[model samples]
Target: MSAETPPGASFPESPDPDRTIEHRTPQPGQATANDAHTRQLPYGQAEELGFNAPDGTEGAPAKRGRGWLLAAISAIVVVILGGGGVWAFSQLSGGGTQPQEVLPGNAIAYVRLDLDPAANQKLALLTIARKFPGIKDSLSDDDPRKALFEAIKGDSPDLAKVDYAKDVEPWLGDRAGLAVLSSGAGKEPDVAAAVQVKDEAAARDGIAKLAPGDEYGLAFRDGYAILAKTQAAADGYAKAAPLSQNAQFSDDTSAVGEPGVMSFWMDLGELADMSGAAATAAPTALESIKDMRFAGALRFDGDYAELTGITRGGAANTLKGQPVKIAELPASTVGAISLSGLGDGFATQWPKIQQAAEATPDGQTITKSLEQFQQLYGISVPDDIVTLLGKSLTIALDQEGLDAQQPNVGAVLTTDPVKAQAVVTKLEALLAGSGTPLQLAKKPGDGQLVVASTQTYADKLGTKGTLGESESFKLAVPDADAANYAVYVDLDKLEPLYLSGLKGEEKSNVQVLRAIGLSGNYTDGTSMTLRVLFN
Candidate 1:
């Protein structure tokens, strides 16, 4: 059976299938031939009755009542004929294609595209382009959508005359989707795409005009048109389970946002296996990752255009309830990051790491390098180095020297004061002849050791005000106590310092980065969120 016709059925063809037919219904205000009072009676009565047609056609036939009934029946027949014609045309055009009919059962990834927001997305792009006077001037002749089409067509004269909105949009239904099927080991995957179109025949004709080569195999089923890399692949897709019907895929994509302009889903584990990495054992921390899905939306506000994405994964349970250290730095700090419960987490995952490392050639080399470093520093790799590193670490940048050019950047290791001091002393001695810039000192009345880029910052540490008291820091980290990991960047303070050194286009390109703050917090080990705020 032909792919255009469904099983056990066939559609008759029409010559003028593209022609549009309008069926108009009689309105209440209009005089109908069936109304008795509307008949041409006496002169005064006929004028008062308003029985004449709007265009002053001849009065109803002299036969009266019976003739009026026939006219009404004739109008009804015309209406039915018009409706049937449209359906017949659609069927002849192969308008019943569906995505499931063209996708393979074992597809690895699926992407769905919704062009409903195409106009809005185009407008947003134009608005962003208008930010640069030169670019805006270049796009002056054509609207954004037409301009984009021309750009894509480039030097192809044939594609320039194609009217996408008229010839393509009607046949393309609400959404278009694609599925990828793995061919086999060491071979490229097969790709199949399905689109819902209003006029299947028109879409097919357009496709033929645009690309007449045998590079793509085409089939139509239901109200969709399916395209595949090969005829066999397209035929197989017609019999396979669609990506939407796959239970695992459905479950994996549950967290993804719906009805967006664009959405994507991928089987991460399957992709890893395809790439040959699955041959090696993965770390326990990454064992739970099965798939990744993301959905994005575009928004324009005045001069800025923002794209936001929400992503979720299958590994939430594996990383739940992890604790993070909260750092207490000085108010003058420009950047800071803190992580808590590292020692315990590292201890649990270290064996798996060692095994995976030893199994690989690169890992073996790293092990040898670590052993050499331990011997050179006269410190045990795990007992002295790892033990002295403690459960949490905080790194921060703060003002220290006489000039802004010499900002103080340092790391605070929360460990036994005596052991941390000893490790610092050994590290400093090892770097004595290398001219590595570092100064280590013990924080007063605490078991923390500070390592700074300058001695002045090391001495001033824990003596000045704390970051917790700063308004910007407080705003960035509202729930500081609850977070197991936190990152904060004071863009307000760094913007001018960085911008002052740039000129012209280089400066304008980065102007969007100014007055923007970024912060992220990982809580409960299972969930992490980052936010970018514009001021």
Candidate 2:
């Protein structure tokens, strides 16, 4: 009923209720990069990538600072945009000012978004968005931001008192940012927000209009307005170090290799420290990702949008396997994923993951359960099955039997005979006596193992065809040949199947997508690219 693909993922959240920032109806989605590619996916070359077509965190903050901060800034911007002031946004591009320039250097996470980006960015956004009827209707009505402003204002009574034209427009600038300023080992993370401002005088006046007391902290720096829980915190931010000074954030940013409309970076080690203090179980599991740093960006290019991300500091696995043979997938294939390096990567890295898992009581219990199953079945699962997947593995779904009693799905695992034959023999003998034998066949000439829902598709897996040449795959995954792993969905081919399974508004939303493609290459660190192609 759905198509799945590999890809990458962002978005900021609305405010909380206790801070009088009530009503949280998130509009929908969001990010960017250019390896001439980025984000379609977090999908990997791992054998068990979660690719079911339709399938489907964190803290209270240093109290209320981050959420209330973002809420406070957005309330200001919403009022300004709703005023319908049409002065050129370029006038307030404000000498190339950015929100990060004012944020604290000790920040564990930071995210920035711009209401007004450069011309190319705006065009790229419109170009990709105009294809969706729901989104396009609003954007096409005139100044797109005004439509956005109205939607954001919605029925939230929290925004009722301020006059947009008089209170906000004359002073508001185009970009804003939110951050977890610091995550100490034992306390909640300090959080804050920065909103750009063109006029200190009117911004101060607007603040007065929004409130009568010192409920929210506020200050000014480098053409931006800083917000915090109390006046002292806001003042401190103006004088404190900025995030640009953090070395890991800079390195991960460089690994991303390109900039886009929106950017995000976070430090997991500091977060882990904060959690480790409070957590009672499996604290070492937290240790596994404690040193990792993550960076991601989102941008729109031509007909599609991309989100790219990088992970640094955590243990990384460098892969050594051939690129996927995407071009050779059968013509009838509706969706497929081919990966070569994951077999070895899993063997090398799984123990590290399992060891961390064992640190928890529940994890230890699960480990014992797995050991018992292995001993009873005479299978060293980690060694035997992993070796059996010695070479490359490809999974394909055929459009032919989607409506039949059994869907046509097949997997072709090309393995080394010497390393896998014994495991294969063991599996065959076990299954033969188990009542429910798996649908598996073998290719003697090439030592390829085939598994499918039916014998017909199992046999058809042997024929090579041209998936890479198809327009949908080509458009979604242009760099498949160079990618160690890639997954694609021929939405145009499978749309009808999905449409019948949907109802009402979901059908309309689903119609705009033509195909989705994701491709990635991993080395010291991983970088991925994803594209959501529109009809």
Candidate 3:
């Protein structure tokens, strides 16, 4: 049984402060001088009132009581409301004003690859997974494709939906496309249905010639049906598939490699295609993610911690420590999803139809590239790794006090023991008495380590680098670690580490790999790829 309900909800009225004040006593003997003075003071003494009197006005005490009451009520309201507001905000937003930190190392970016049955008859994607990084060298008899083939072919229905194409399109462009078949079909039907009907006279003739057996849907399987009966009702089915398999998937799937292969012999034209697509996608993707707030953080050693404070776009500094903590952070808006899910989200919405291939076909190549990207570079960037790449600290010997004994030294210098204690001796004699101040700065041959180029430079060096490339340079100066006075070596150091071939390869081998997952196979059948990122 239900109870009867009230028409409207009721709430208690706020207590009124003015109503709490009590009336005071009246003075004795009215109209006399003594009575007038007493009345003025405590509503009783006029001579003693002084400036406290309100021009001998009546009801002065009552006015004072009202003012105090109002003040008290206001204060109470402020405290109550302020505290409630803060508490309510915390409850609604999960507390705190700052977002959590995301470490790079903790993140596990995934690349999902779904093979097209018609494209490649291969029963599994193992033929393709063997070429990817980490997996290539690690694949064994127990799990030939590393975890990739199992990740795809395993009975785990949960993993089958992993989509690399969706997650990395924004950052890696069509590279994601080349790896996975994005889940959308082409704009128009690849095949259309058509039917043919025969007249009654024809049907009668065919009935007489009818023999042992006949199949009704054979033509329909191929695309259509033909009827040859006279005055007979006829029906047919027409089916359509994408003219180009690539069109069925998103752009990221287009750049993936073939099965059983690791790398591709990408020519200048192919590179141009990848680069152009990436260029167009980057700005759009960045804008989409600009408002994304992430939670989670990476912890680093003190030396690396200081580097995190350094802005991007500056010279690289060496950290004194051997290891730093990196955490993978997530945005509060969405609870944490797997690295694979993240990739799929991007592919499902990636844009770039303006430059689609005319008749692109899906193949084993795509599956391999997708697997490689996931095992190697990854999409689920952990917060810790990001921190490692984002921040760094410099260490050098501090010898300022030791140089005080020398002559005419204009300035003092400090040094860090970890980074360049050995180099400190060479400079001690020169700075002993001194021709100039012993300024600290970056040493030579140490430019390949800088991260957060643009932000770091803008904050510390008052300069910036190009966006297409993440540049790091040697800051050549007087000492091993100083903020002022440095030089850049773009061609000498940065280009070699980031843009050139492996440790021993020709300059012409400056081939680029799709960071999202697209990998290549050298002429020697060896898989090779490179990945770079910027915060």
Q: Which lDDT values do the candidates have, in the order given?
A: 0.49, 0.62, 0.20
lDDT of 2 by residue, 12-109 (tens): 13132121111111111222211222212111221221101110001121113234345544543432222222112221111266677788878888
Pick the winner on TM-score between candidates 1 and 3: 1
Better of 2 and 3 by TM-score: 2
- What is candidate 1's local distance difference test score? 0.49
TM-score of each: 0.60, 0.75, 0.15
Which portions of model 3 miss their true places by more than 4 Å? 1-134, 138-535
lDDT score of model 3? Answer: 0.20
Per-residue C-alpha lDDT of model 3 across residues 367-442, encoded as one tens digit per residue: 4564574455433223222222222232111112222343111111121222232333334434653665353332
The CA-based lDDT of model 2 is what? 0.62
For every candidate structure, what is the RMSD over all alpha carbons to the true structure, in angstroms?
19.7, 11.8, 34.8
Off by over 4 Å in 2: 1-95, 140-156, 211-214, 245-247, 277-290, 318-322, 349-372, 417-437, 444-447, 500-509
Off by over 4 Å in 1: 1-106, 112-143, 155-176, 194-199, 219-225, 235-241, 256-261, 280-332, 356-372, 399-403, 441-448, 454-486, 501-509, 514-532
